[model samples]
Target: MGIRSVMLPAAIAATLCAGGVARAEGLTVGFSQIGSESGWRAAETTVTRQEAKKNGDTVKIADAQQKQENQIKAIRSFIAQGVDGIFLAPVVATGWTQVLTEAKDAKIPVILLDRDIDPADKALYLTAVTSDSVHEGQVAGDWLVKAVGSKPCNVVEIEGTVGASVAANRKKGFDDAVAKDPNIKIIRSETGDFTRSQGKQVMESFIKSVGGKNICAVYAHNDDMMIGAIQAMKEAGLKPGQDILTVSVDSVPDMFKAMMAHEANATVELTPDMAGPAFQALNAYKKSGTVPPKWIETKSTLHTSQDSDLQQIYDEKKNLGY
Candidate 1:
């Protein structure tokens, strides 16, 4: 679906137009990022800053270091500084009500990037710009189903942080998709905390526990973890793409590079340009009083070795801090 089709409440839409175009020119926004936990996140941060710069606005960023408390602190600080708007990539889905209410009371429009908070506090934010993570997982699962055909496969999953909404939803989607085929079984699962180092470490343990030969496939919630899993597979004297078919989310540059080398299978893209639509929606809201949808779904395109533009994709994404 197109980004502009997402709809938000008309009540909150009015707040976005208080100062109009003049205020948007030098718009000072505070972005609370979840930290550079993975390449995807780093790219998100890079794109967010770039989007802010493109709009002739200033963005003050606060790195939450994957801590919800840090994010809460940053949001409160942003409110104190009276930033025109706040962009939050919440580390978790809960405990955001009080601080978000504070931002609402201060008349600051808060936009969520890449993830969504609980529906209970949905009214506190202007809108959320994120991909349908469940759809991404389903895409990954669907690809694996087609790749494996009727073959019985033992799959291992490297998940994101335990409590993160993205992790939960992606897992659910994958499970739902694979449920259709009894031959596809997830034998082992663990959280990699969405970092390459953690993914590698967890994968090392998985390799040891599951044994290199019994595994038929591996699924990671993000490409970073899948990349780490690839290294572990290589070290274990197993060819990842050939021996244990790999599928993952987040079409980061390295995934394409892995695909080019025949070391990985497929990845679903989770666009880092979340801020692009966010800024556009904010501008539209301020300029024409448009109420953007509460949820802006980004593209969830799947990429595989068959894709001809691997080099181009890698080159384009390489400089995005991934």
Candidate 2:
């Protein structure tokens, strides 16, 4: 069978159990989420949970609270429980080999959702479902360059978790774009851990140290941090979008609201609806005992005030439980 048409092994388990005696429609699946740190993350959880129900599958979810050890423990527990399959949105890429190997040895296929691992190894996961993170960063960078024009701007980067795929790729894309323009200087950069609270705290330091007057722009890896940074700027008596331009990824409804309110300048959309396609793939695999592509790339877009599709997309996402 072609890889593109392959399916997850759990879907196969759903069938071939005579009279549904061995495996019921309530096939238990394990999901380890990256915690409810952002709107995008919340939407992902809502959609995945709803999809599992719609497909008559029972999902056991573990919220990692942004801790790698917690996620590993959850995955191991799922393995002990002998779940049909397991899915994890890894907190960071490295240090996952051992746990993944345990899952593999337990005969429970693993799926990577909405994040990626560095030093890619095929043995760790059957497939990964996520967006082109680097592309998102490049889009954000391109927009900033055009908006800033030929002006020499000092930038402060608010990175995500230290080693997450989104953080690494987004920063890489931003750096690549900034490199083309020698006038764009990154005066400060630090990991915000993809949390709103952390974003605010880190931006506080930047504001106190740089005085916000000399800073040209703030680039955040995700919208949550951007919002937090905006709050910090407000507290410092500095206007966010006006005094210092702001750019971020994840076009969540909150970000859109921020853009409409003029707190955020622009955002790149990273939709949170992987459930439908994931379920479809599972169905195909269960019926055919085949595998799907090693990686499935989702669509993304740039959201600016000039775009008419914002309200419609935002409305749709809100309905999807974002």
Candidate 3:
């Protein structure tokens, strides 16, 4: 089914209604995305556009291609264009204060999507809509612990981009989880830069250094990296799900496909419908002069083989441009 044909969740539907047609209709918003870095990011962009259309609003998107400077320029452009609000998925956690101050000076309410910046200038933006990255990592790690039991396992980790808040929080959460289990240990850890090619390269080097037989499992920061690791294991003549248990965050459609094929063990979902809640908050703010909470947390659902309708989930997500 197409994205438009898919039914909105009851809560989201209620949120849309709560905004009221009169308050949300014809509102112009600018969205600055951090480029299509992975399937999950692409889904977020797609869902943002879909939500905007559903609410009778127009969204002008600027793809920053994973650069903070580009995002800053986009925000300035949005300010010059006199948009009602701006949605930003920052590429990094710093250097946003001045540009956000400009947006604030222009009287544009800025909403952060998926990522956040330094808190020193938190007042500049209206609110941040994002999932708890630490929680997502904890979910993945907890699943791995349960699946491995008391067996001694050597795990390899494929991390996200260096210095990214998501990467740091995820690493911290997984470390906190595994710290409880002395039998489970991570032997190799390296950055994949959140790209499939880089993930594959890092995994290849890991396989060479540790040898596939010595490695017990692989934990990636995201599904794209996990998918890349799966390919590396296959090429090295290792059964991914059997010989080396696989787990990661971001329950994208491709990860579901891997799970169905028994190439992956588990994944934690980072929902893409951030814009729905953002628009709801924007509408409420515009209608009643009410200020929303500084942070709005989205769900972090976990998916594994036990889920009966993997194919159905895949079908739904595939149409969302994932």
Q: Which candidate wins on TM-score?
A: 3
Residue-by-residue lDDT tens digits, candidate 3, 1-322:
5665555565565564454343544688999999997667889999999999998988999999999899999999888667789999988888888999999998999999988788577798999998999988898889889988999999999999999888999999898898899999999999998878888899999999999999998999988888888999999999999999988998888999999999888899989999999999998898898999999999888899778989999998998878
Q: Which ranges in model 3 have alpha carbons more than 4 Å from their true place?
A: 1-26, 37-39, 65-77, 80-82, 92-99, 204-211
Worst 10 residues of 3 by lDDT: 16-25
Q: Over the stretch 1-322, how does candidate 1's per-residue lDDT look in tens digits?
A: 3444444444345454443433655678889999997777899889888988988988889999999999999998777666778999988888898999999999889999988888475689889998898898999999999999999999999999999878999999999899888899999999999888899998899889979899999999989889998998999899999999999998889899999999998999989999889888877776787888999999899999888989999998999998
Separately for all candidates shown, the number of backbone clashes (residues 3 or more apart, or on different chains) is: 5, 5, 0
Q: Could you arrange the candidates by TM-score from highest to lowest?
A: 3, 1, 2
Cα displacement (angstroms), candidate 2, residue 135, comes to 3.1
Against the true structure, whose lDDT is highest? 3
lDDT (Cα atoms) of all candidates against the true structure: 0.88, 0.83, 0.89
Candidate 2: stretches off by over 4 Å: 1-40, 53-86, 90-109, 116-124, 161-166, 191-193, 201-213, 235-238, 288-290, 312-322
**TM-score for all models, in order of appearance:** 0.78, 0.70, 0.80
